[model samples]
Target: MIKTSIQSSASEIKSAREDFFYEQPGSLPGTLSIEEDAPPPVIVLIDYNETHATRKQVSTPEECIPYLDSKSVSWVDVQGLGNEDILQRLGNVFKLHPLLLEDVVNVPQRPKVEDHENQLVIIARMVIPKEHKIGFYSEQVGFVLGKNYLLTVQEEPEHDCFETVRQRIRQNKGTLRKQQADYLLYTLLDSIIDGFFPVLEDYGEVIEDLEEEVVSKPTRKTLEKIYRVRRDLLTLRRAIWPQRDAINSLIRDGSTQISESVRIYLRDCYDHAVQVLDMVETYRELAAGLMDVYLSAVSNRMNEIMKLLTVISSIFIPLTFIAGVYGMNFNTERSPWNMPELNWYWGYPLCLMAMGAIAALLVVFFWRRGWFENYSTIADDTNNKNYGSKINLLWRRSRR
Candidate 1:
């Protein structure tokens, strides 16, 4: 799971590097699509009963239609919705509504849930970390829950967190083999909910790293990443908040399709969803506070830079004017007022000493005033490995 999260974060950072901007909102649903290079769908299935179980990759959605009506549980897993033709046909074979198919094909249709008469459709966002980066790539997952079968749509063939569920069913490791479709739905939802843990853990690590960076080495990009994390967390918050309410409504409002036994499982799923939402909200608050700190740190840095420049100019200006005055070669022999200071044997050394003394005095004054120490005291290093390098980086980058 940790390896998977690392890969997800790397992928998202790379994708984000491309500078993909958003279009106008509320245009239409299922509007966004995959490029021509997208891989074809890979369909896998699991059919099981208390007595027996089977798992295989089926070639077409029609192949599963017969099993859908059977007494045993059927799970048709479609990973990749790039082939819109196959997706539309799959919708037909399963008697899916147009909007539901649209939602499934739309790639990222906002992690959501919708009711479609006899079918219960759920949209979830799952994160898989990239191989070597610091953020996670979010993928949309759509599930169509029916009376005897469950159909799920995944966006990529390269990623999924269903291995545990598959192992449980194959080994009959749990009561899953004897359960109904709704229980299967819970199992999948539980996996998706659990998947957020690693992603959230990644963010927690990020926030810790950021707290140090912001206070010690605040950069424009650091501010950018903070805002990005806040924005993505908001995306997450918006996604999970509704699903919690949706699940709560299911548990409280009562739905016939959800059995009493499955309702209990859904309640557990709801709890996990609520937990995810809570963590996201907390992270959002922390990120916002970090932004404020970043702004103040940057402002403080600017003031420090200006103060250094001011000190240099203030000490040098008067000294330069005094030197300019005596350097004039007017002969004191012709007039005593002409160059009396220059006639003094110790004049040059005295002026030099005075300038040096003034500079040293200003330094001591600033040091005593506690102005330099205040800004320098804030240490912002995250990820305990970088003890001093990051601090030095901040020092070089600091203005004053």
Candidate 2:
């Protein structure tokens, strides 16, 4: 039953691996297509100054225009892009270029940074670790920065890393209230970059567990797990690699939309992105190595099974020969020489004794060669080592 389950899981993994999504060839650029099941857009406005801060939900894009030109900073956060008409009005409200709107609503533009005449557009990918699970949720976040207002768009409202940033603004925490729109952009971007750490930490723990499983008791499920981890890390790498360059471009290009002080902060964000990329690459390599280890462990297990079968066959070979000789029908009534053993009363007992003696001798020979002892000892050692490490981990966690 266990073997059947393992085979079933292996087949599922193979099927999943063969299924991949790709863009249609020769697709038009700046396409603004939306998913049919996408949720309606949710608009939120946060206007703040050094002395006061206010947050409210806006129903229409034009409602945000009154606060956009104020001396204080305005953050217009749009949570969905289900309605094309609303998104178009939002583009007009912010004076955003058509291509910029397309990029924001397109759901998954690669992470990038573009500087327009008076605005800077940033496309970033954000990841949130799933609750009570071993995977992550990923989405694209687009930012459009203007003189006194900053606009941000997210594909969905269910999962976002910007809650803390919102809280800081609401509570007037730290110097966030005093800084300009550029500073708000930095805070949000920093939050997005830092979010990768927790997700990566989850992957790190999973990899450690898989490492132990692959070494001590690898199964088809273990191979599937390794492949899944590698695939996720690849996705994360794809999201972060272009983001790092986008940040570096923001710093190096010297966009007037981003202040010098904010650029310094962006440099720090760049370092965090680099660290994330490093960890992802390391995990990917480790996952690949774990796959090799799993294959080798399975091969060794098969060899051990074959060795035991061969030993059993070797012990039975002489016993089978002895039985064949005694059971031969060579005309015992006509020729005494051919039927001497068949006519003797003690012949049957002697033949049985001979076969038993031969079996015992072979068993003793195999024992002396240490095959059985070696196999048992190796299994015991592996189990003991795995248990010891698990116990140590529990002890450390308890201490913490």
Candidate 3:
């Protein structure tokens, strides 16, 4: 199931990349454009009042008509968008405006709130953290609030953060049982807003882990991860930023379906949206900083490599010069002064001794100058021992 869900999510994202699901140019208003790959609609009805509550899966939209007229609060959750006929029937049953139905069917619309006389339509985006992954599954959720009923349409059947709300309704926990449909809307919106915190926590953890990896030893893959993180944060920001305005509109605008008390609760939900936006923006800045850190790390590594190569080359230059001079083909017989040392009994040994002495002196000079401390630091770090005493003592002696 996990694999299938992941695959479907990947497909959804691919479609989003191609283009958002939109109506064709010159198309009539309220024209519905359903994706060919959308899953069939599944409607669930939950009717509850202070005294009694009932939950059941309704096969057809008409089954929900009777409950909408009751004094109790009815929540009709319609998941998936595969069947247009069913969605149309559902809209007709609820007496939804044609344009309102269009917005509900359209997947991936910007988050916004529109007051349609007695009905309050809220377009929202919900995100669920991907299982065993660093990203989240995002989908659009549309809410149509009436006098005694709230209709919610979602893009898919799975990967929603509304399960907690469902559990609350089922257990009759909190004041959800007593509240009207507007209050129920507030509760669900609050749940959706609160859901962002956990996903943001995951991102925070990822940023922490990347900080360590980027500083220690960054790689091409690290760069890719950083870019991915930035992209995802941007996606999150896009999702939550508009939501703030939408929630604000809900609070600021007048609506008969939304009561004064529910509007007050929505103020809290608006605050949560602001918090999510803050976290997203902060994460985006951190991700951008990570990119800079990755570049600096790569450059530092390159410089270290070059420094090591330069040190090796500097040591070999003198040796190469001595060897080249000795390798000359000058004849000792022709001139004693030219090659007198070539005939000495210990000439070969003396020459090797001289070369070794010169090399040792160069090494001491470079060491006292503290040029190789970085290498020592690496060694000491790995062994977890103070291996720099000798170098420090030598440095002090040379300074004296």
**Alpha-carbon lDDT, every model:** 0.75, 0.83, 0.81
Candidates 2 and 3 compared by lDDT, better number: 2
lDDT by residue (tens digit), candidate 2, 183-231: 9999999999889878887787888788778877888888779877887
Instruction: State the displacement of the C-alpha of residue 121, model 2, in Å, after optimal TM-score superposition.
Output: 0.5
Cα RMSD of all models vs. native, in order, equals 9.1, 5.4, 10.8
lDDT of 3 by residue, 154-225 (tens): 989987888888888888898998899999898889888877877887787788778777877798898768
Instruction: Flag regions of model 1 displaced more than 4 Å.
Output: 1-35, 345-374, 379-400
TM-scores, all candidates, are 0.78, 0.86, 0.87
Q: Is candidate 2 or candidate 3 better by TM-score?
A: 3
Ranking by TM-score: 3, 2, 1
Q: What tens-digit string does per-residue lDDT give for candidate 1 at 1-400?
A: 3553455467457654432224347766544465576678999988999999998999878899889899999999998867877887898998987767877777555555676578888777776656576666667778888889999988888887888999999899878988899898889878877676566666776887788888878987996788678767765665577667767776786665679989888887887787777677777787777877787888888888887788778767777887787777899889888878777899889988887887788778767887455554465335644532333233223313
**Full candidate order by lDDT, most accurate first:** 2, 3, 1
- State, as a TM-score between 0 and 1, how close model 3 is to the true structure: 0.87
